[model samples]
Target chain A: MSMTKLTLQIDGRSIETESGRTILEVCKENDITILTMCHLKGITDVGACRLCLVEIEGVSKLMSACTTKVADKMIIRTSTEKIKRYQRITTELFAAERNHVCSVCIANGHCELQKLAYDVKMDHIRYPYLFPQCEVDTSHPLYVLDHNRCIVCTRCVRVCAEVEGAYNWDVMNRGTNVRIISDFNTPWGESITCSDCGKCVEACPTGALWPKAVVQGQLNKAPEFISDLIEKRKMKL
Target chain B: MRVRKAKKEAEISKNDPRVKFLANKIKKENYSPGSLIEILHTAQNAFGYLPLNVLQYITKALKLPPARVFSTVTFYHFFSLKSKGEHTCLVCTGTACYVKGAQAIVNELEKQFGLHSGQVTPDNKLGVAVARCIGACGIAPAVVLDDEVLAKVEPQELTQKIKSKLAAS
Candidate 1:
């Protein structure tokens, strides 16, 4: 099958690309920055997090760059004032939704969510703190599931099902009440399907899922590792 | 306690006629994964609420991951994982109803019965809940008792009315 050629302008620069690639991919190739949370390169994109929204010239609403395909002759603006404002608000909400005390978190400086807040210049949250009674599940023996720090990006859910093929982590409930559950809301140590792989721990953007071996400020995760593995697996050799 | 709970759940799945109805519905739908919502509706209707065993049975019958079945069930408000009680009082808290003193009625219920919305009495006789809207704005301040919609309800009379309903059955 031959790849279809297309022309598009991003950030006022004329670029030529092939079809079947997302706007985010085109932006990355050109060194344009697009913020995202629920996107994992190896697996599918659900566009759950709205951080990658970009303003297309003809479109009325902002489109998520990770999921929106690059069309012919499209004009896209990735860093408009409106997009920045929305991104800041989104970052603020993530902070206020649960208890994310960065100073005490396991991932601290290494956390993607904390880094996102710094990038967006989110100093103080305007939204009310939900202070929901979230759970900290230490039943896995090897890992911990802390609901307080989760943003519900479902990165762990996707990576577990797609990369690890364990299908152990899934979200339950909706809105502010939602939570990641293991096999019928059972304790992680009691899961019948989990292979005890730590792929989910690495895929987690926040300190929501972490290995029990690591303490506060000692955590390191490489989501890019999953993407790299996928690329190598696709080789014919 | 965990073992006991599991055993009781197994007993229900083994003996309940409702489980048979749910199984029949699943079979009729050919156990297609696309029919998940429909099967869940049948299961909810037959069982009055979705239990763990019923969800597990559906998951097995459809050959789907337990997580998938659970996520679908929790996404929709129409399905309840817990019982809505023997009798339910659903107050409409939509704009029109709120303007017509729906909050007052809710407050009255909380004060009188010491049970907030989404909560059932200790005896499990009556459950209190609130709806975004019941679409009965023509009769704002509507409350649904069981399946009957009571319109233009007063806050002071709600407790008495609920008590009477509970006493009936």
Candidate 2:
């Protein structure tokens, strides 16, 4: 399979990319920052987060850059006020659920969700917090449980079942009460078949599955160097 | 008969102090309804588990009521309000780890321990869990035991390592 190279314009910058690459990838390669929650590097793009919505010239509605592959002569705008408003509202909706107390959370400083909120300048959650009932499974020794921090991105679920093949983690319920669970909905500690590897915890973009004993104001996240490396590898391929 | 009674008595004492300590700690922190999850982490570290009383304390402290706290605790995979065994073994089953036979290693460990995933032995000596991706995919099939990483573990090597660790502990 060969990919044809094509030139496209993103936010006024002209760049040449492969025919089948998404606009998000094109923008990312060119150092453009687009807000996204559901986009994971080297994994299938679900466009569930809705944070990567971009205004394509001639498109009827805003399209998700994650799912929209680039075409020849395409023009895109990523930062119009309209787009910012949409991004802000979407971020607030995420913040409106569970608990995102940045001051005392483990991922306060280093969380991607927190950074995204800061990027959009969401000083307060305008909408009332749903505060859905959620459980934290602390059966695993190395990590802690805090469901309130989850944004329902499903990155952890996809990485665990699809990428890791353990199928140990999943979003068990639906709608407002949805949450990530382990085998037969058992406690993580009770799942004897679980490998206890902490991959899902690491893959999580928020403070959902953090290391045990991480200080409230000092959660450290692994850098995005690997994601960048994966992107580079995909481009090379 | 006396030995059985003593064992039961000792178990109660072992579980009591940790639970009481967590309850007091959560109270000291003043974790409110909105901040229950944040305090849950603190409780996990202070007690090595989230006991029933600690959850009750959180409900009362946060003013969230009981059912709400219970539902939240059951909703996330990361929360553990129960007691765990002495040792924990986690295998990375991320994309890189999967391609590297992390699954096979997990299976071997399950067999050797005479336990299934998420179960502790009757002796309560060890617990096993699996993670999706630990971001260390470069070293596929990564396994972490008590904060130490064992990379590129073959099936035979894994069994031997677990045996040695269990024996030493």
Candidate 3:
């Protein structure tokens, strides 16, 4: 099938792209910097983090680039001052939501949330810390699930269900009370459906999910590995 | 012995009217996963709240993951995992109601019953809850007890009604 070409204005630059692709895909293709979380290449884009919000002309509400598909003759501004302000606020909230102590974390240097904070130039969180007592599940023989560092991105949930076909991880509850559960909120080690594939650990953006073998600042997660594996699987060789 | 015990428990569950009602409702819904919320509503109405076993039963019947059912149950505020007690007092704390001293009513209930909002009495007789808004702003301070909405209520009057409700056989 031939792809239909469409024209759009992004950050005052006229670009021509195909139909059915999302604004995020177009931005990435054009080398336009658009921030994103809760979006991994291999699985699906839920647009939960709301970091990739772009100001579309004639639209009052800012649309998330990851989920909103590009249309014909659409105008989009990625980094307006207002957008930057909102992005900084979102980064600050992610910091203040839970106890994300980078120094003590396994993925200290490699954490995506930490990088996002630096990218947004978030020096100190403006909001008051929730300080809710979160659980650290070390029940999995090879991995750990720390709720303190989790941003509720649901990447692990998607990866487990989609890639590994385990369907072990799922989100429970709502709002601040929300938590990632394994097999009806049971311990990770006790999860009957988990295939012990560790794809979830690889897809996690923060120190929320890490292997037990890694200590503080030693964890290195390769989320691209998931997308790369997907590409290899599609090869006709 | 364990097999006999299982059979006995199954027989008792089969005889339970609430369980029977839930089974019939699930069957009526053609066991579709989309009817989970509807089934849960019926189950809650029948059993006062969703017990773990009832949720498990629904999960099994719907062929859904336990986590999925659990997540759905916890997402909605209307659904409660624990019983809301025999008598429930839901005070509206919407902007309009708050301005009209709805907080005073909630405080009075806490003081009189020694239980906070979203809490039930030790004996399971009374439960106190707060609503963001029930859309009854005209009657600024509205309270719902046993599904009956009481409008323009004073703290003392609300307490009096609750006391009477609890005292009744």
**Could you arrange the candidates by DockQ from highest to lowest?**
1, 3, 2
- Which number leads on DockQ? 1
Model 1: lDDT equals 0.90
On residues B1-169, what C-alpha lDDT tens digit does candidate 3 reach at each position?
A: 0111121111227779899999999999999999999999999999999887788789889987777888888889889999999999999999999999999999999999987989999999999999999999999899998999999989999999889988993
Q: Interface-residue RMSD per candidate?
A: 5.6, 11.9, 7.1
lDDT of 1 by residue, A134-166 (tens): 999998778999999999999999999988888
Candidate 1: residue pairs that collide: none
| Candidate 2 local lDDT, A87-196, one digit each (tens) | 99999999998877787787878889988988999987789988777777676677766798888787766666555556566665457877766644557665423556
How large is the C-alpha RMSD of every model relative to the true structure? 3.5, 20.9, 4.1
DockQ of each: 0.40, 0.02, 0.36
DockQ winner between 2 and 3, please give it: 3
lDDT of 3 at A188: 83
Task: Give lDDT tens digits, candidate 1, residues B1-169.
Answer: 1121122233344556888888788889998999999999998888778888888888888988888888888889999999888888999999999999999999999998888999988888988999998899999999998889998999887789888877888
Clash-forming residue pairs, model 3: none
Model 1: CA > 4 A from native: B1-11, B95-114, B151-168
